[model samples]
Target: MTPKRVVIAGAGQGGFQVAASLRQDGFDGEVLLVGDEPGLPYQRPPLSKEYIKTGNADRLLFRNADFFEKNAIRYLDGRRLAAIHRADATVELDDGQVHGFDHLVLALGARNRRLPIAGMELEGVMQLRTLADAERIRTAIAPGLSLVVIGGGFIGLEIAATAAAAGAKVTVLEATDRLMSRVVSPAISAHFLAMHRASGVDIRLGTMARGIRDNGRGRAAAVEIEGGAVDADLVLVSAGIVPNVEIAEAAGLYVQDGIRVNDLMETSAAEISAIGDCASFPFGHDGTLIRLESVQNAIDQAKCVVQRLLGRPEPYDKVPWFWSDQAAFKLQIAGLTAGADHQVARPSDDGAKLTVHCFRHGALIGVETVNAPGDHMMARKLLALATPPTLETVEAAGYDLKAVFAAVSA
Candidate 1:
């Protein structure tokens, strides 16, 4: 059955891509891109990086009003999806606007997780997941401003670097022993730790922020730790994100860490599909079911679902990749490094470039690169191969990635 109408539930990157890809694929059906925000879909990454540094919202947009009109995508901004009526193949908006669909794509995305602190609701406390959040933080950043960031992950550190560069008194409080412990390797973490510190950002490792102290005037004044508190005019809670899976869960679809989906990006319901950060599918590398929060996953998964709907069903097997821009350093990862028993760290002569090759069961599985774009690009190709170069091969070649790739292909 041909899809006459496709209603996308979330208008983030993934949802926008689906609508755009469908139009590019020559789908003339009714494509409605619904979003909670009252504007065209924009890139979320720059909200913490480029947007923070330049304060230019123009660079964040994925498309303009003219593009949507030209492509025939019915974009509904500031509209929230209230319910999914799967029985009738319809979705209900919060304003009671019911729209029927032959196919429904859920790109609901995720929300910033809240800290269990007392002063969380106080003024000067912020979280950055949307344009509004970025605008809130933008007005708070200034020279000599005391800002304390809780969580040393990519978002936290990125904000810390940008704020510090902007002459703000920035301090990072990471509960973990190392920065980005859940994602990057220890060597990469140490290098970035040094980089942020050198840039005048005070990063405290293994430091747990128990609570936020309220000022006498009813705002967040300090971050209370074990023995002392870090005084701050601004507190950024970048603890992590929680997927917006409530609607899917309320509809009784299989919901785990995210909306559970198969390799084909199909939800428990055959007619409904989930993609991007909100969907937990089998990891393309190791087949370990996991959800990713990256632009690569969002765009690739959107393309995959479109292909399936267009009668060319292929397994969602794109190699996952990610990048973080903190000041001058650009850290990129080619694949999942989780559960890798062996890892080899290689660096350039000047100690500026690095690549951490992770191997599992003697096979190259993932690579973490810092300021090494060439190696990062090659790592993605290597991980995509049916037979990636082994740890021994890389070691024998003196970690010459290009040579190993040529040898493997040859």
Candidate 2:
């Protein structure tokens, strides 16, 4: 039974992929993409990096107007889903438009998590999530301005580096001792810590940013720390994000950290599938489910779900990969690095390249490469192998991933 009408909520990258993939895969169905934001779907990663400096909003667009018209996609921008009627297979938008759907795909992305700290209401404090937010920061940033970033994650560090390069006095306050502790190995964290500090950016580790201090004019004056306040003309909160799953939960779907979905990306109820950041899909590891916020997950899961709807039911199992560009360094990672008990760091002779291999129970779990594109590409190929080389094989190869990969391929 081919679905006639397919409604996808949240026109972010995932939702856009689902709609585009459906048409590209020869599905002659009605595709409706409803987005809360007004405009074409754009790339978010550059909002903090390239957009902060260049302000080229036009380059961020995934597709222009003609693609939608040619593909016959009914795009409803500036619309939010109010409720989902699972029984009737229809969704009501905030504008009171009830659209019937043979299949509903929830590509709802995540929103920035606002921490409960004082002085967050200040005028100069902001969070980078949308194009409008980036515009505000680009207009506000200037040479000799004091910028304080509250988180030391990839986004915060990348923003810090960009600001510093623009002649802004950048300061990063990380609550944890190691930078990117939750994702990367300590070796990779240490490398970035040194790289950032060498670029004249002040980085404070294990330092909690308690609150923002307000200026007399209702603006941010400084960021209050354990010792004292640091003067801040602008403040950026990169405290991570929370998945948007309220609509799914309201419709009585199972919700954990995110909207829970099966291997086929189907939700608790049939004819409804969930993908992207809002979906916690089964990982085929120890029967546990993990939600990824990377672009790879969004694109791959969308394709997987569309295939299922087209009667080709293949499970969504793809290698996870992520990348971050800070200053001159590009860090790329493959596979899940969580719960890794051991790490082996390999640095080039000139100190220009490095890769950190993470192992769990003597098996390779993940690989993090800094400024090494070749290693990063090989790491992804290696991880996709059914039986990746063990820690011993890697050690025997003198921690040379290229040689290890070549031998395995041989």
Candidate 3:
């Protein structure tokens, strides 16, 4: 049966895409997007980059008030999903309001993993997840102020670079041996490590932050790490994120690392589906269930769900792509880097571009490019092909990726 009404939970990137895709897919069903945050849905990537510098909240919105009205998508902002009555096909809000739906979409995004150390509740200690969090950090940032960032992931590095550019004495503490150890290749990590360090940011690897030390006035004064304490007026914890799956878990959904969903983005329950960062679905060559926190993943999964809802069911198999801006370099990645066995680095003619080709058993698995949009675009195009360019082809072309693609086609 076609659903007459659809209720979407959470209004992050995925949640916003669900409503827009439904309209684009010719679904006339009444759409209800419920979010815990107030105001229109906004893009989160800029919260750590441009938004920090400009403080322009208006530019972050995905759609303004009129877009919702024009599309007939009802938005319930600043409300929490209290309970999900699976049998009754209804969702109750924290305000005691219950809404019935023939179909339900859970776009519940992840929350920042909290630092368990002491003095964490003190003022000036913050986490970046929402626009409000970015505003707090912006208000706290000042020239010559000590800013300590925990974790060297994309968010942490971006914040460190931005703060350093703004004249804050920034220090980053990462528990991992190298920056972005769990994601990017070692070559890429080394590049960024040097980039950040050269930009005057102190990056400490394999350093664990034991606790945050509070100043006499109840504000964070320093972060205690291994061997010594790094004095700071502000501390930003970008350690990681925990998926928001309390409501899904309570409703008896198959919850693994995240809400488990099949390729069609359907949950174990017939009417309920999950997408975006909070949902784990099978992908990759090994078909392992993994949840990705990229905007591309969220948007692609939402489109797949919309297709299924429109009676054209297809597996979600979009190739993952991601990018980050730190200091003067723009790092772009195509395909998954997990389980890659070897990598080849190619420096461009002028020395401005560098592309790292990752391979697993001689097959091109992923590509990481620095300040090279053409290479990144070509990599994405090649990854989408039925028979992608191989490592031999790349090496034969003398690392000129465009030549490799041309040779393969010719």
Candidate 4:
């Protein structure tokens, strides 16, 4: 008997992983990977930092041409999935080809949110989300150039650090009260704000970009803040990302915050599912729908869907984790803390490392650490266990989170 065909839209991090995982699980199906971007599948995280600083495009490619062929995966590059023909169980591409699928996966991922302001069409204005975007920014970075970044989120700060280190005068304009306000604690935000400032990057908090001005050369020259103008040779808008769900919505699929998925990453429609940044799966703790854009979420969710397709009835319940490399600090987060009610910090003896414990109504929910990988690893392990150590226990153990867990288990 011939195996069924599995068609995936959006050849991004999750989409590629889904294809690879399906084959790894011994699914002898015709796997089709469709993407709008031209070229092989690549990682997006390095686009802001390492790729921008060193311009290494090769490292971003997830797999070479041989790997795709060896796995019998059909990679449809440079073609966008225009619509999903649910009744016929086929995906209509922009080039007028309809590919039938026994199972359909939507891993469309997310795109950088464009700011609505004047001079956004200027030549030097860029948004770093794809390898193409990173390449353009890499060519633009030069010594003595002034760069103004809008938004103080992870991408903005990382790009600012890279541009500043490359000899660019960088200024970050954030409308928020503090940097990383939505994710990190006030203490962490203050620490990062000082880090950027000390690195010669002018970080303007509570400053909104009203508009952009051109330098009469069709290039962005200055960013108009709330009251003043900051001169910039280039402007990078690193605000945030919005999930790409137009195809799913057009196909009559349910899309709330993102394409709603069940524990198995299955969508409301039969034979169809969604994952990665384009998917809003169930949060185990609150039973609320949550969409995560991290690589870990994408990889884990893809594996879960593949397992389900391979006759394994496993619900996706993996803990969410993420990491950001900024300057000399490595920030790691384990689990989701959206509804965290209390937070406690355990500073290291040298004051160079810190671990924050987040609790929700007296139950440990998440942990954030700066320059503390061991603590972050322990937090992930402990959070998975039936009972985790208390915040007081973590502190009383001399900030040895792992030792605290070991002692409790012993």
Candidate 5:
């Protein structure tokens, strides 16, 4: 029997993982990983944080070059997938090459949303998304340099923290009332706002960027807000990203917020599926269509897709988890809390450790922890368990929520 051919587009985190997981699941087929980036697959979470400050490119690599050869995964770097010929079961590359596949996975991920204000075309303004973006930001980070970050989202705040720690005057401007308002809870946002303020980051909330001013030599001189202007040598636009689903949509696939996929990650079209930031799947608890851009989501969903390809049908119902490292704090979260009604806080003895439990109609829906890994781990287990603890039980267990969970489990 001839081995099956699996062609994956967008060789980022999820794209690369899909190929690896397919082989791991005993699918001895031709795996072709295509990415527009010109190198091996690498982790993107550090691109805005550590990679921007340390310039440690080696540490960002997901796997070595030899691993691809050993696994028989053909990686085509610096090549963009212009179109998907779904009818013919082939992918059209920019170089006019058509690769046929028995199965196709669209892990096209997302692209950073660009600022529309004036002077954005200036040289000093940048966006952090790919390795090249990190390289540019890394070289621009110098002591005494004024760095103005637009957007108070995770990427912007993480970059702001790194820039501040590197001795740069970092100022974060967010149009929203709080940072990370879309994904995290109000308590978590307040905690991070306090943390950033304490770390000397000038955070300006409810502020919108009017335009950018150029010093006439094609470099950004300052960022203009509604009331006044702040002088900045470098401007980093860390706005959120939009899913890359144009090609998939052009190929007559369902596109709603992202490429719509079923529990098995299969799209509307046969022999074609989507995953990662570009794919919106059914979230278990609320049964709502959700798209997650975290590394954990990408990897776990890739595993599910691989299992399905190997004829092992299983629902992709893994608990969602995410983390963000800034300065000395590691903020970890387990499970989704999209429509939670109430939140409970549990602070540690030292006041540095904090955990916030999100409840939807008295049931534990999500958990947010800062510098508290044990509690975060327990929260994941509790979310996956048959009977989650009630709010009353959580309150009776004292501030040490992990101990309460442990005692109950024992």
Candidate 6:
């Protein structure tokens, strides 16, 4: 049965992509893309990087208004989805408008996790998840001002670097022992730590921020940590994100860490599907479920959902990849490194490039490369192979990624 209309909730990258891909697949059904945020869908990655320097919000738009009109896709901005009536096959809006759909897609992305500490609501303190948040950050940051970042994740580090470049006295508080400890190898973390510190970023690892000190004037005065406090004019809470799974859970969808989905992106409820940051699918090599919060993950899963909706279901098996740019350094990772039992680190002759090969039970599972795009690309190809190159082969090649790839392909 063909869907008469497709109502998609949460108009982020994944939601927007679903509507466009559906049209591309020749589905002329009524497509309604609803989002709580005003204006068209925009890329969120640049909110911490280019948008900080440029401050041009127009450049962040993923598609112009004409594209939607041209494609006959209905876009509803500033409209929140209040409820999903599965039996009625309709979604109720906060405005009391109810729309029926033959199929429903929940691309409801994640929201920034809150910092559960005193003075969280104080002025000059903010989180970076939306364009509006970034604009606030730009307004708060200035020359010679004190900026304390609350996490060592990508967004926090990126913001720290940007702030430092803008002449702000920057300090980073990471609860873990090393920068990006949960994601990258320790060697890569050390390299970035040196890079950021050389650029005048004060990094404090194993530091727990107990609370925020608020000035009587209604602004964040400092971040209170163990035994001391770091004075700050602004605070950026880039701790992490929580999936927007309330509606899914309320609708009785299978909700675990996120909305549980299968390889085809179908929710436990047959007619409903979930994708993007909010969907936890069994894509892990060990069959463990996981959700990714990257643009690549959202966009690729959106395309896969379209294929499945068009009666050409294919498993969502795209190799996961991610990148983070902090100042002049670019860190890239190919494949998942979650449970890697061992890792091999290699660096260039000039120490400008580095790569870390991760293995689980002696099988190559992932690769992390810094300032080495060529090697990162090769690593992607190598990991995609049916027979991944062995650890011995990688060492025998003397960490020459090209040679290792050639040897394996030959």
Regions more than 4 Å wrong, model 5: 1-3, 403-410
RMSD of each: 0.9, 1.0, 1.1, 1.7, 1.7, 1.1
lDDT of 2 by residue, 1-410 (tens): 77999999989889999999999999998999999998998879898889999999999999999999999999999999999998888999999999999999999999998979998889999998899999999988899999999999999998999999999999999999989988899999999999999999999999899999988889999999998988999999999899999999999999989999999999999889999999998885675879999899999999998998899999887889999999999999999887789988989889999999989999888899989989888888888888878999889888888888987888
The 0-to-1 C-alpha lDDT of every candidate, in the order given, reads 0.92, 0.92, 0.92, 0.88, 0.89, 0.92
Clashing residue pairs in candidate 2, if any? none
Per-candidate clashes come to 0, 0, 0, 0, 0, 0
Regions of model 6 farther than 4 Å from truth: none
C-alpha-based local distance difference test score of model 1:
0.92
What is candidate 1's lDDT per residue for 358-397, written digit by digit as tens? 9889988899999999999999998889778898898887
What would the per-residue lDDT of candidate 5 be over residues 1-410, giving only the tens digit for each residue?
Answer: 22399999999999999988887777887999999999888999989777877899999998999989999999999999999987788899999989998989999999988878999899999998899989999999998999999999888899999989889999999999998888888988998999999999999999998999999999999999987998999999878899999999999999999999999999998688899999999987567999998999999988888888887879888888999988888989898865789988777878898898999888778899999998898888887776777777777777466766876687
Off by over 4 Å in 1: none
Model 4 residue 391 distance off true place after TM-score fit, in angstroms: 3.6
Worst 10 contiguous positions by lDDT, candidate 5: 399-408
Superposed by TM-score, candidate 2 places the C-alpha of residue 357 at a distance from the truth, in angstroms, of 1.0
- Model 2: CA > 4 A from native: none
lDDT, candidate 3, 1-410, per-residue tens: 67999999999999999999999889998999999998899999999999999999999999889999999999999999889999899999999999999999999999999988998899989999999999999888999999999999999999999999999999999998999888899988998998899999999999999999988889999999878899998999998999998999999999989899999999989799999999999986678989999999999999998988999899888889999999789999999886799998877878777889999889888899999999999888888877777788888988777897888889
Give the C-alpha lDDT of model 5.
0.89
Provide the global lDDT of candidate 3 against the true structure: 0.92
Residue 294 alpha-carbon offset, candidate 2, angstroms: 0.7
